[model samples]
Target: MPPTPPEPAAVLARPHTAELTGWGRTAPTASDVRRPTSATELQRALPNGSPRGLLARGLGRGYGDCAQNSGGTVVETTDVDAFTIHDADPASDTVLVTAEAGASIDRLLHALVPQGLFVPVTPGTRYVTVGGAIAADIHGKNHHRKGSWCQHVTSLHLQLADGEVVEIGPDRDPELFWATAGGMGLTGVVLDATFACPRIGSSRLLVDTDRAADLDEVLELMASGDHAYDYSVAWIDLMAGGRATGRSVLTRGRFATAEEAAPAAGPDPYAYSAGVLASAPPFVPDGLLNKLTVRAFNELWFRKAPVRRRDELQTIPTFFHPLDMVGGWNRIYGPQGFLQWQFVIPFGAEATLRRIIEELSASGCTSFLAVLKAFGEADPAPLSFPAPGWTLALDIPAGVRGLGPLLDRLDELVVAEGGRVYLAKDSRVRPELVPQMYPRLDEWRAVRNRVDPQRRIRSDLSRRLGL
Candidate 1:
C-alpha cells in the first residue's frame, strides 16, 4: 500500500507582538513573532511586501541580533522538527543524517553518541541548531583539524523569497551554496540539510592539560603542541597582571577509546548524560559582576588547574558544554545583560592580540570567560568567521561606563590588523568596517540580490552591518 501523504502544514499561528532579544539578552527589540510549524507554513508567513521583512529564528542561541528583526516578523522554526539517522554501512567511517533547520545539536548528540557517532564540528555549546551552525559557519576546538561546520555538509534544501524550494550543494549551485553557507539567514529560510558524521569509539575525550605562565608561553605551547591532538583550547585568565597577564590553562584531546574510558568513567563507556544543575534567579541587582568578583573568580579558576596532566578522561558535556550545566547562566550578568566580543587576527598579528590583552587588563575590564584558540584554514564562504589565526572571545558586562568606546577601539585594531569579528556574536560593529573586515562582502551581496531581489529576508545585524 502507498504511504499516505503527510498532512499539509496547518495555517501558521497569527503573529504575536513580543519583545525579543538574543542569547546575550542585549538590545531587546519588539517584533511580531510568527510560529510556523513547517516549511509550507514558514513560506506562508514570509513577509513579501511588508515594510519590515521576515527573519528565520532557530533556538535563539545566537549571541547577537543576526536572528532578530526589529519591527518586523520573526518566524520561529522550533516546530519544524524533522530528524532521521541512517544506519551506517559496516565498511564506512561516517554516518549519514538528515535534520530540519530547528533540530538542536543537543538533540542530535543524544541520538547519535550512543551509536558511536558525533558531529563533525560543534561550538562551545550544543544548544545551537543544525541550521544555525551552517548559517554561522561555526567552528570548534578542532578547527585546526576539521574546517568549519559547512565543510561536512552534503547539501541543503532552501526556501527562497518567491516560495520556491531548491536543493543546493557545493557542486550543484556553487555560488548560492557558498553564499548561504555563512550568509546569516539573509538569503532565505533553510528547510533541511544532510551531513556526514564520523563514528567515534566512545563519548569521552582523552585530554592532556597544561598551565602556561604568561601570554607568550601559552601561544608558544599551543603552536608547538596543538597539532599532536585532534582538538585544543585554552582558558585565559584576563584578570592576572604583571608577569601573570594572559596566563592560561591549555587542554588538548580526542575521543577516548573504550579501554581508556572503562578504567576512568566506569563500565558503560558510551553512556551520555547532561542536565541543568542549577538556575540563576532573575531580577538580580546590576553591577553584581563587578571587577573584584570576576577577578577573584578568575584567580580561583586558574589556580585550580593542574600544573601538568595527561590523558584525563572527560565526558563530552563536561569538556565541550560546561556552561550548559547551569540553566539561564546568562542571568548571572544581571538585568543589563552582557556582550560577547569575539574577534580573530591572522597568524602574524600576534602582536595585535598582545596589545588588546594588555589594554583590557589595564582598563580593568572584568571578563571571566575569556578563551583563546588558533584556527587552521578558512572555508570559501564569504561571510564565514574563521581563518588561519588566533581568535579570542571575551564576555563583558554590558553598559560598562567606557565599554562602547573600548569596543570601538578594539574594532579599529582588528580591522587595521586585517582581522574580523564574528557576526554571530556581534551586536555593535560599525557599518563601514564590515566591508573592510570581509573583503568578499560584495560577492555575498550579489548572490543575495539574485535570490532575494525585493530584499524580503532581513535581520537587525544585516541592517546594522549594512550587509
Candidate 2:
C-alpha cells in the first residue's frame, strides 16, 4: 500500500523547497518554505507539522541561524505585511503604530517619516520587519535615550504552536509577552505589534562628531557624555595598534528641530530616501579583506571624520545606517562569510573589555567594522540582550587564522565577566554556556514549553543552544 500524502492544508503550509541563509551568508539550511497570508491560514498548517518542527522567518535580516529551521517548515510573513498608524499626540510625545508580522521598518518609515513620526528604536538596518524587531528585541544607536525595541511595544498578537491565538503585552499575559520579546521567535509567531513611535520634527539629525585618541579616552568620553545625546555610537579602527589602539570616531546626535534643519533635507524636512548607492559584486575573491587592505581602509575612514565637529546636519541614513547604503554588502567577505561578534560586559568589567579588544587587534585578523555603544536600563524581557553595560560589536572574516578557537576563548572571557553575546547575532556559541550567559533561560523556556508543549516551533539556533 502506498503511504498517504499530506492534505491540501498541510501542502499549502509547505509550499516549496528552498535553501536559506542569514545576512552573514553563513550556514545554509534547506526547508519547506511557505508564505501564508494570514494567521488563520497559517494555523491550518499547524497540525500536519513535521517532527523537525517549524519556524517563522521575517525579512531574513538576522545575521545567524535564529531564523533558520533545517529540514522543516519555514513560514515567511512578507505577504502578511500591513500596518495602520493611529492619531498622533505630540503633546504626549507619542504615536501608536500597529504593523502586521511582515511589515518592514523601511516601508513603515517611508510612510511615517512624512508624517513627522519615527520608530522609537530601530536596529542598524531598516529592512527588518516589525515582527523580527520584536523577536530580536532590537536596540538602536539611542539606547542611552530609548531602549530595546520591545520596550516601546504596547501590545502584540502571537500564534502559538497549537494554533491558539493570544494577545500579549506588558499588562496582559505579561509573562508570555516578555518571553516573546527576545525569545528569538521561539515562543510563537508574532501576528501583529502595536508600539509607540516618537514624533520627530525632521528626518535630519544634529550630529556631534569627536575623535577619541584611544580605547581609554573613548570609553571615558562615552561613559561621561553619552547621556547628553539621544543617539550615540563610536566606530573603532580595529586595525590600529599601540597608542592608536581602539582609536574611534564618536558620533552622537538627536533629531533636528524644524528650525535647525538645513537645505539637505530638501523642501520637505521630514522627507527620507532609502536608496542604495552601490551593490557588492556577485563574486568577491576570498582574502580580499586581509590585514593590509583593512588597515588602509581604516586609516582613510578615520581621517575622513572631523576632529570635533558639532551640530553638523546629516540625514538619518548617513548617521544611523551607513552600511545600508550598499546592497548585498555581506558578499564582500566572499564565500565562507564572516562572523559578527556583539557582546556586552557590565560597566565594572572594563578591564575584560579592554583585554578582549587587545586580543582581537593582536590576533592578525583583519576587520574594519567595529563599534561600541553604552547600554541603558535593561529590558523587561528575560531573554533580552542589553543591560547596563558597554557593548562592542565587530566583524571578522571567517577565513582568518585561529577564528573559532579565538572566539571560543573570548566567549569564556565574556561569560566570566558576567556578559553574554547577542543570540540574534550568534551562530557558534557553545550550548553549555547559554544557560550561564542567560540565567533566565529556564524561565523563558517554561513559558515557551507551555505554548509549545511538543516544542513544535524550532530553529537552528534553538537546537544548537538546546533551547
Candidate 3:
C-alpha cells in the first residue's frame, strides 16, 4: 500500500535530527521546519504577530541549543545562500564580498582564496554561516592580531520582527549593529552581510611547532612568541597532573608566499582534497574516553610534531583544522553526546585556570581535547564572549553524571575572575550566572527591545538563560 505524504499545512511534531555540538543527535520537539529560498519568502513565512516564537538556524554547528527552538518555528537559512564580490581596491588590500546570511564560510573561502583573498576571521570549523558567525561574534586563532569576525563586517541586511528590511553598518545604526553582532539572533533575522576580505599571499601556511612543560610555561611561551606569528594555538594535556599538568603542544603559523610553497607538480595547483563526511552509527560505551586513553593520545601528539621548527608549508585544513581529517571522530566519546565547555579567565586569573584543570583531573572527567589560547583586546559587543584573558576549552561526554556540577563550579571560578563563558558552545551553565558573566546583558536587552519590541525573536538558549 502507498503511504500518504504530509500536507503543506500539516502541523506535525517529529523527532528532529541535526548536527549540534559536532555530534549529530535528535531532539524531540514540535518544530515547523521552513526553508525559504528567497528574502521575500522568508519574510512571508515569519509568523505575523506580537510576541512571536521563532528562531533562525544556519549550518547547525553550534555546540549547544543557541540555534535550536524548543517548540517554535525553525527557519533553516541554507536555501538563501547567494554571494557576490564587488570591485575591491587592491591598493587598499581590501575586497568587499557580500553573502546571504546562510552562505557557508567554507564555500565562501574556497571562492575567495582563488582571488588571493581570505576571510578576516574563521572559527575552528568553516561549516558555519556568516549569520552564525556574527550572532556568536566568533573569534579565531588570529584574534590576538585581527580581532573578532564582527570587526571585518561592513554592513548587514536585517529583517525585523515586523518584516521590515533595514540596512545597518558601523556608522549607521551603530548601537543596533553592535548589539546584533553578538545578540544571538535575538535582535532580528540576518538576511545578508558584507565583509572586507583580507589578501593572502598563498593558500598554504608556514607553521612552527613548540612544546611546553606545564600551564605556566605554555602561557609564558605564548606571551613571548605571539608577536612573531599571526596565528597561535595550543593543545593541552588535561590529564597531566603535578609538574606535567597543562603540558601543551603549540603551533603557530602565517600565510605562505609563492616562493615558500612547494612547486606545483600538476596542472591543478590548488587542488586539495578533504575527507568524506561520516557519522557515528550509535553511541559507544560510557567511559570510552578516559584519562588513560587521552593521556596516551596526548603523549603521541606532543612527540609527533617537530620541535622548534622555523617553517613548514601545509594545507589550510592541516594547519587550521587537523581534526576534520578524522570522520566520525566524535564517536570516540561514546553515544552520550559530549558537552563542550569553553570559558575565558581574565589576564590576572591564572589561579582560576589551574583550579579548573585540577578539578577536571580530580573528577576523573578528563576531556579528550583541551585547547588553551591567549585572547587579545576586547570588542564593544555587549554579549560578545572574548576578552583580554586566557581561554580554555574542553569536550566531555554528557553521560558523566557529575559533569554538570563540576562545570557549575568552573563557571563560578570564571565569574570570580571577571571572565565569561561562550554562549555558542554552552549547554548547562546556570541562568543566574549569565548576567554576572556578561555585565552588558541589560544593554543588549535594550537593543533587543528596540528592534524586537514584542520580544518575538527567541531560541532554546534564550529560554534557558532567561535572556
Candidate 4:
C-alpha cells in the first residue's frame, strides 16, 4: 500500500493555500499557510520529513523574507496566543508575564496597562508578535538603557523538528537560547516565551523636541544628552543638501507620571487607544512618490517643526509609531511595493555615515521617512543587528531605476566600516557579504545545525543569505 497522507486532525488545523509577502509587500511567494490553534496541534502539524520544511510566521511585520518560505509551509502562529500576568515573582524583583508566541505587543499593552505594567522593549510599531520580536530580538528607542527584547526574555518553549518540545533559557542550553534569540527561526519554532514586564505609572510620554541644523548638530545633541532620556529618536531630512544636509528633528522622552498626564488627558492616566484614521488607497500610481514630491514634503516637514520644545505630552502611538495611524500605508508605495534598508555602524564610523548621507542627498534619492538612532550596546545574539553605534532606517520605492547598483555600493561601504544590515528589514542584501557583516554567523550556524541538522526548518531568507 502507498504511504498514508497526514491525518485530517494533523494536517487540517485551519489549513489554507495562499500567496504571502512580508510587510514590505516585496518578494511575494506561495505557501501552505497552516494556523494551528494550540501547542499540541502545532506539534503534529508538520510532516515527518518534508523537503520544503516549515517556518513559523507571526503578524508578518518583518519587512523581508525571513518569515516566508516559497513552495513550503508557513505556520501562522496567530491562533496560539494565550497569556498570564503575574504581579510579582518570588525569585526576582520584576513582574513576570508568560505570553504565547502569537500574542501581539499591542494586545499585551491593552491587558497589562490597566494593572500598571508595560513591555520592557518595543520597536517602532506594537503590531509585532511575541515570537517575531524574539526571533528578531528587536530593540527600541530606549535600547541604550534597557536593551533588546531577548534581554527581558527569561525563558522560551521551542518545538524542534523531530517532534519534541524543549524549554531553553540563559541558564539551560544558553548557546541554543542565544542563537534562537535572533536566529531568524532557523533553530526551531518558538511556541511561547516568559519575559519580565516592568511596572509603569502612566501610558503617556513627556517629550522634548529639538530641530537640528544638520547631521553633526543632531549627532552631537544625541550623543551628549541621550543618557538622560528613556527614549530617543531623530527624523532626518535625507533630501537636504549642502549646509542643511541631514537636518533632523530629535525627540526624547520618558513615561509620564499620573500627575503629569492629568492636566490634558483627564482621568484614567493609563488610558491607551490607537485607531486608524484612514487607509492608503489600494492602487497608488507608480512614480507617485518620486524625488520632486518627496523632497518637497521633506522640506516642509523640517521647516514646520519647532526649533525647540519642552515637556510636550504625547500618546504612545504618536511617540513610537505614528505610521500605525494610517492603515495600509504600504499600499501607498504602489503595486511594485517598497523596501526598507536599515543598517548600523559603530560609534566612531560617523565619517562613513556622513558619506552615505551625502551620497543619498546628492543622488536625489527620495526617502522622506528616514530615521536615525544611537544604539548603545551589543547583545549576545550572534545574528542580532544593533551595536554600540549609529543606525539609520529608510524606505525606497522598489520601482526606482539604478537602485540595485546604488545599494550594492552602499553595502560595500557599510561592510568596510564594520557595519551590518538588519536582516529583519532587509530584502536585497548580498549573500556573500552576510558572513563578513556578521562575524559570528558560523557560531549561530553550529547551534542551528545541532537542533535541525536536516535543515527541515528553512525560509526564503535563509536560502537567500545561505543561512
- Per-candidate clashes come to 0, 0, 2, 0
Clashing pairs in 1: none
What does candidate 1's lDDT look like per residue over 367-387, in tens digits? 885989999999989999999
Q: Which pairs clash in the backbone of model 2?
A: none
Residue pairs with colliding backbones in model 4 are none
Q: lDDT at 214 for candidate 4?
A: 96
Per-residue lDDT of candidate 3, residues 61-89 (tens digit): 77778887765677878778899988866
TM-score of each: 0.96, 0.95, 0.92, 0.95
Candidate 4, poorest ten consecutive residues by summed lDDT: 42-51
Off by over 4 Å in 2: 1-14, 38-40
Q: What lDDT tens digits, residue by residue, belong to model 2 across residues 1-467?
A: 99898785676554888899888889899988887887566666556566798888898888889999999988888768889999865587989999998999888989989999999898888889988998899999988778899999999999889878899999999999999999999988898999999999999999999998899999999999998999999999888888888899999999998878856676789978888999999999998988889999999989898899999999988888888899999999999998788999899998998889898888878988599999998988989999989999988887776898999999999999999999999988989999999999999989998899888999999988998
Off by over 4 Å in 3: 1-29, 48-52, 264-287
- Model 2: lDDT of residue 185: 90
| Error at 227, model 2, angstroms | 0.7
